[model samples]
Target: MTPESAALPGAMHPTDQSTQGCTANGEMILVVEDDVELLELLGTLLKSAGYQVAMAKDGMTALESVTRGGVQPDLILADFNLPGAINGLQMITQLRMALHRSMPAIILTGDISRLTSRDVAFEHCVQLNKPAKLKEVTFVIASLLAQQRNAKNDSERPGQFAPGIARSSIIFVVDRDDLFRHTIRGVLESHGYAVHDYATSEAFLADYAPGPPACLLIDAHLPGMEGVELLHQLRKNGDDLPAVVISGSNEVSIAVDAMKAGASDFIEKPFGRSEMLQSIARALEHSQDANKKLAWMQEATHCIDSLTLRQRQVMDMVLAGFASKHIAAQLGISQRTVENHRAAVMTRTHSKSIPALARVALAADLRV
Candidate 1:
């Protein structure tokens, strides 16, 4: 479908148009598209639907807008085949790194077949085909925004259980082959894991939620979206469920692509049970370690934000490798006072040594 088709009558539902002229409730959206007319149309559409819209013509410009950081978007809509070296996924990845959080996003693509799984493995993201119906676009945006709101509310709720603690032990299997799915399910169930099998990736995605500590075993040659693409979708949805990709071919490139798409491991067909179990164990461990590190970094950032002006100064000097006497001289303070401030910094930040303190500082984005 062409861009002109998108603007035809009956393209947008009556309910969607009813939102026009309403206040946006402070939600902001970033739209990145290279086509000038399409970009304007999207921006106008979003604005009419009660959203504050920001527009960028390419991936580079979108990235620059994010880095400059005045208006942080509540959601992002980016074209997949953006001009320049950085595509939409890369731009979203860069923004996520800078913000240290997963931001919701949607990718619009003209030729969905041209994209590989590696192009979609971004946290809190989904893809939509180009010339997308206005109703479909509005529905996706509303769903993502609603999910974000629910997540925030849950986090802020008092006395909530920590993430992954109450998760079900159900393993998900996605494969086109009936025998393969049956075999895997039987094996996993024998090992004390409840198993759910699906013949298509779309079926699995439709039923997926982020509430389970389960692992995914997916076949590389599914009928619709490939295994790698399924893994990418899982990651983009902010579901950190560990995944293992099973492929009949022993091609190194296929394995590489699977791993690049964020699969925990790639296993060739005819694998032993022991090998599969070990891979699953390792993926779970990796997920645990990643969660721990993210928690520590968030705590450290909070600690850094609580520092006094003098304490922060002392920390900067300490990170710069300055001795106590030198720091005292530089700050026009006594050596004993400098030592006291340093001790307080370490105590408040829970740093055992200078190197540990430096790690906390770096995680908090402090520069010396």
Candidate 2:
């Protein structure tokens, strides 16, 4: 439908009042959903909120209604996994093609893991998880319409930010149990963090990207890839992001493995909010300090290329809790040679002491 033809009168026609109740002239919302109960609930909510409502049971009908019936829906709320051949993303794409422009849309889904192209690119398009409260739905819809109206009035105005805004950070939440995703998201959102919850290692890996949250909270026992493996993957990939492991396990071996794999800290699950927050804060603080130390180490390394490879090896072992005798045995060098290399390394790097050199090595990504 052309823009002019799809624009309906301000109010619902008198004949439509009995089913939807009286509605004021608000934005027109077209809800295309296959679930009957969900559709009716959403329709009633929108109608009560002063919107001129339209409905379609599937993508084909919705497309037909718009292209042939001359119904120009101002905004669309659709399901990601829809019945029949056309899905929500395809429908929106087709609509944009037919209308020669993009229309605002929301994808409602039970599977939050399914992210479409529209969700990633368009700031106007939102994803609302299934079983959304009526008030929550109303708030999101109103917010979008307000944004559109504001843009119309002054295109230069900035868009609305979600409440409790903060800079983006890496958020690693691992829970084999499905419900924790919602709980963790709520907790983080309440504290002004934009949260991304992962159900499994596979999900996290698939969705993984650079520049994630400032912190990670991972469950110790994730499906397929355990927390240790996940941490190893991140470390191997050169992502030194701060991470906290949440585990129900009490085995010291598990904790040791996690630490060896580069986990900043570990905490037992069913932990109180205070414990969780403290762990996260500590990890972030350590990561920040580690980054600074690493920068210094890199500068030092550039100036210390004169040291032999064996001297650097001895330097790493000494700082990693090895005495001269053990360092000699490990590197197959004599104790005297290990001592000489250790002194040469410290001198070359200008490290004041063995402890300082060890810190530098850690920052420099030493393997031992």
Candidate 3:
């Protein structure tokens, strides 16, 4: 069909509601999704929030709708995995070129790696890793559109969305046993924790979402990629998402292996609900403590990285208990100059004393 003559499949002409007292300014939003249920849900959500909504099943149709004048979308929310060969990122790029300008977009994907700057750099594009809550989705949409058009700052009208589910923590349960997984999920849900369970490690990995306070429960004897192996792999990939290995066997050796693989805790099967809950609480605490330590180390590393080569040299010598005169003689510079460099290092690192500077180096894992 020709661009102008072709009709969009699921286009809705929502009344252009006033921008006053509302986040939506009656802008058109194109939603490209293959999941029929999700498409309808999003359509309803947007329409209620006072937006002109259009729906396309795939990237090709979405591009056609915009390029053909059937729908002039002000914003686009597309699923990363679509039916055709064209992915969400590629579709966003082509859509921009067709429109003759860049526009704000949100690309929802299960792949965390797609959140890299390179993929989201063309314009005011944002990558929201999947398995995200509906409120998160709406929040991003509202914020991006507001920035794009300088719309009203009113929060999403309170009654426009599903009643907010107050969740304490998110939990992932990976086990080969469907019955057991469901049981655990039910328990977590009853406790007001958002829980998702998978029958395999691969499935869990496929839907892994980063940047959330979450933990994992993995069965030690999983059919493929056993729990300890999964923990090892996650640690190797530098993912510190705390995990607890659940095993049917109670061998000390298995627990030892799990600990070595970076598991925060190990639990034997036939465990009580209280035991499981306690382990999860402890694991979460461990995760929070680790996060604090990591934040401190990141700040330390940033300070150390800001130093010049001379400042770093002086810092190293000073940290190693070398006097200013000794550092000058070794580097063939004046003692006064060495002292000046040391002062700069201390100031740059925000260290008031030599011992404080040494602590920063230790946090950064820098060698003396």
> Which candidate ranks first by lDDT, i.e. highest?
3
Task: Please report, as a residue range, the 10-residue window in candidate 1 with the lowest summed lDDT.
Answer: 154-163
In order, the Cα lDDT scores of the candidates are 0.70, 0.64, 0.72
Candidate 2, superposed: residue stretches over 4 Å from native: 1-25, 114-124, 153-368
- Candidate 2 lDDT over 315-351, as tens digits, reads 6566556689998888887999888887788887776
Which lDDT tens digits does candidate 3 get at residues 1-368? 32212222333222333334338889999999998877877787778777899999999999888878668888899887889988886787678657644567888777666224334532336777666556566667777787767744322222111112215568899999786786677556645568989998989889996766788989999877788888887888889888878876746457556665767667765654545665676567657777866877799899999999989998887766678899999999999999899888989899764534655676676875
lDDT of 1 at 167: 38
TM-score of each: 0.41, 0.36, 0.37
Model 3 lDDT at residue 277: 66
Q: In model 3, which runs have C-alpha deviations exceeding 4 angstroms?
A: 1-22, 114-117, 121-124, 151-368
Task: For model 3, give the 10-residue run with minimal summed lDDT.
Answer: 154-163
Quickly count the clashes in candidate 2.
7
Stretches > 4 Å off in candidate 1? 1-24, 114-118, 121-124, 152-368
Candidate 1 lDDT, tens digit per residue, 1-368? Answer: 43322562322322343323233455889998888876787787777777899999987888778788565888888877888998886687666555645567888766565223323531335877655667677667877777787674422111122224213366788888786677566545545567889999999988877765777888888898988888888778776788888877755456655665667677765564545665665565556678865776698799998899999999887776678999999999999999999999999999765545665676565654
Candidate 2, poorest ten consecutive residues by summed lDDT: 8-17
lDDT of model number 1: 0.70
Instruction: Indicate the TM-score of model 1.
Output: 0.41
